[model samples]
Target: MTTQPERLQHLLDRLLRGVLLPEEAEQLAGAVRDLERRADVSDAVAKGNLRHVKQLIPAVRAAEARVHELEAEVSRLTAGQCTHSLAICETHHAKPVPGCPYPRCVAARATGRAATA
Candidate 1:
């Protein structure tokens, strides 16, 4: 016979797959809250053995830290590229820089008159 947790897990799985009955939806929520309380684990993670879950915490933290670092790097690179493009746009004085890849810059260059000294 399946245990309550197992049945609750099955219900939760069905709920996640969009197949649960209306009553089962309520049941799934209650089961999830109760199990989460009992396990003292994050709701973000639905299911795992205790040992594995414990092991994953640090790994998850590390991966999240790495994600933050990469996000910062991406932001910095994008800002730098935008600044470079803007500078080039200003230098060319509304014209596209000869080798600049921005289509708007190219359009501006095509339409813009030469800058007066």
Candidate 2:
């Protein structure tokens, strides 16, 4: 059996040639109405999706702002603390903490070249 699009094309071609039978004309009209109904449903679905996204925007923005605030609080709390790993200070640039076992931390303390926060 031919697909709906193919059937529609055939009917359209017959109509254009001015040789479409009454039944074929009815089929063409039905296909056009079905296409219009599908378009209307799709438009309604899209509008609904847009409304949902609009409703979510303020909540999303508020959550993002809270995340930024928490990050800032973490930064404030961690200020003046060593940011390097306990095992190694790769850059040897982190602030030295007393009794740290890492050689870089010891060397930085000895040389007084450790970075200050």
Residue range 1-117, candidate 2, lDDT tens digits: 999899999999999999999999999999999999999999999999999999999999999999999966654433323344643444433665555556666677788876332
Cα-based lDDT at residue 40, candidate 2: 100
So what's the TM-score on candidate 2?
Answer: 0.67
TM-score of each: 0.34, 0.67
Writing each residue's lDDT as its tens digit, candidate 1 over 25-108 gives 888788878877867656434545666888999999999999999967664554346456665444544433344455554565
Clashing pairs in 1: none
The runs of at least 3 residues in candidate 1 whose Cα sits more than 4 Å from the true structure, single-residue gaps closed, are 1-48, 87-117
Error of 1 at 87 (Å): 10
Q: How many backbone clashes does candidate 2 have?
A: 0
The global Cα lDDT (0 to 1) of model 2 is: 0.74
Clashing pairs in 2: none
lDDT of 2 at 19: 100
Best by lDDT: 2
